[model samples]
Target: MSILSALTLSRRPATGFVIVGIFWGGFAAHVPVLKAQLGASDALFGLLLLGTAAGLVSSMWLAPRLDRTLGARGMQVAALALALAWLFPGHMSVQVLFFVSLIFVGGASGLLDVTMNARVSDLEAQTGRSLMNANHAIFSVAYAVAALISGVTREAGIPPGWVFTGFSVVTILLLPVLRMAPAAVEPEVGYAGAYPLWPILLSGLVVLVAFMSEATVEAWSALHVERTLGGGAVQGALGPTMLGITMAVGRFSGQVVAERLREVPVIVGASLLSACGVILAAVAPVPALAYIGFGIFGLGVSVVAPMGLALVGKLVAPHLRTEAISRAAVMGFSGFFFAPVFMGLVSELFGLRAAFGGVALLALCAVPLALALGRYPLRTAQIRP
Candidate 1:
């Protein structure tokens, strides 16, 4: 393909999707460290994450309407505000700063979540191909990079606040994309009605399971390794490295193969792959085996969320697809933000091993939802655009 064609393929939502993944992926890598540094208990951590998801859910309903009033760039600016606001949580005393910061972080992450999807919805309309998986692959790579950077920073004895602050500065890259993107014009004359909520909700449920599984790995794998498996902290941290690498590979390549498959079979195949991976990883006799398990798990789930998200991009009415996508995404976000806390609780209650088993179980949890999404593939789903 020519450079112009590649650029065209990547423009609009595809570009924003990558940036969105990179920024949030950084935030994701820090959860383990954040929990450790704050000395937060499991239930508290879950609640804090839930608060963030609450913010995202609220933004989902508001984003498309706001898009109508302000255009895509306007929505992007609102999201930018929230991303900046997330930095304060890291510096707070566990007693005071943590909860307050959690609220801000969740809200900001949530806002960005909705706005970016909205941007991608429009961009997909223009680009006319399945870009979601590739974009999420960008997120996986960024997530791995972010986790690695955080590991290095932790080694340097930097606190979470400083790490987040650095990311905040890096967030300035978002401004140019927001500025250069054109405003949404009126849609094709036939556009009408909001996206039916049930299908989107079901799709959201699918993501909720997949992301929850992912967050379980990202947030707690290190703890599981060091505390449960009797491994070094740094060595323990490699779970996400493996997961991210596998996810990136699967998703980047999955996007190509996904173009050849329909929604259901791909999701079913990927879900089964992830479910099996998690069971093997979680039950592995040793840490190395567990690492391999996580890699397989990553490959299994890597495609689930992006493919679901791509469905979101195609399903709803043009004006409302972003809103619909956000709604679906908030469910997944809730799953992600909530899963760590639940795992922490499981660790607190049973053991880290069993808690991880909970994560493994969700792979199966996702299968039903993925099948649900697949069942109704014709429910207004257009091609990726």
Candidate 2:
């Protein structure tokens, strides 16, 4: 491999996430097209989204076994299938094609979701460093670009024709990217025995709360700006944009610090910052402070998930690390998936501001979890699988 390609492959999690970012960006962009094609209600659109949630959950059931059998090569293949799945339905009716593609993308995403983290865990062994947060930050960058492209195209009056045509180009590009990954097990340096589930479950609980706050900001930050702070709705949309920008910056910097300051304090400090930001934003009588608060919260969450994943990666053995990751991932996914409903119920009872801002409380709760994680920080020598 060229030195550049080798350096690139060294960043396995980021490389894996490149494929993920493009699809996620494009699929979200494609949602309107699906709506146009299916003539479906917003309610039905939500139901269709359920398929993705189902696929994600379902993959957890099989991911452990798949990881055991196929290793990293299997993950590479899964990435390929995920990229290609978007290329389907060339000849089908729009509605049928929309649903089919969604299901395919969901399954493909689920597989990648489980396997890539496992590979990150594996790569950490070789490098003996905490790099997973940097990898995830790269994914966020890709998603930002994707979302930007989609929005620009729509605003420019470009037809959805560009969606398939452009995204197909990304798929073709990812094939070369996936083809060059390092093998998973040429030189396993740590234990490969069965992993204890208790720590993993604890990790999952932490992930769940972390994700709950993350999801809330993602979906409701703007609404909070408009409804509570009396901002123009257009101004409100900037919440996640600011959040994303700050978060991308924070995660990139945090990865550098992951080796220097240690993950535990970085995480606990981050959680506290996030919680404070949300609470400030929630109570702010003006839109500007709310935006500032969202920015801080985004920066805080930037490292928590990746740090959590790195911890899981560090604790387990090689063959079983993949399962350990997905186990935690499943719980986190459930938390994010259910957060919206919980918000809705809370909104009905209290108000959108109260319900939406409650996510700050989730971040506040993560403070102790972050500290507890320090008590059992994953040792570098023990990372495998």
Which candidate leads the pack in lDDT? 1
Q: Compose the digit string of candidate 2's lDDT tens values, residues 168-283.
A: 56656665455434335432555464446766876777777877787667656655666567754345545655666677778777877877787678888898888888887777
Positional deviation of residue 371's Cα in model 1 after best superposition, in angstroms: 2.8
Per-model CA lDDT versus the true structure: 0.68, 0.66
C-alpha RMSD values across all candidates: 3.2, 4.8
Question: Worst lDDT window (10 residues) for model 2?
Answer: 1-10
User: After best superposition, candidate 2 residue 89: deviation in angstroms?
Assistant: 12
- Candidate 1 residue 136 C-alpha distance from true site, Å: 0.9
TM agreement with the true structure for every prediction: 0.87, 0.79
lDDT of 1 by residue, 1-385 (tens): 3223433565554445544555455555566677776777766676666656566666656655665666647535764675587567667666456766666666666665666555555555666556667667766877777666766676677886887777766666556655434335345467665547877887888788887888788766666666667766456657666788789889887878766887667887888888888788667777898889888989889998877777765666655566677788878887755775787678788877787777777778777776666655453433333
* TM-score for candidate 2, residues paired by index: 0.79
In model 2, the Cα lDDT at residue 37 comes to 60
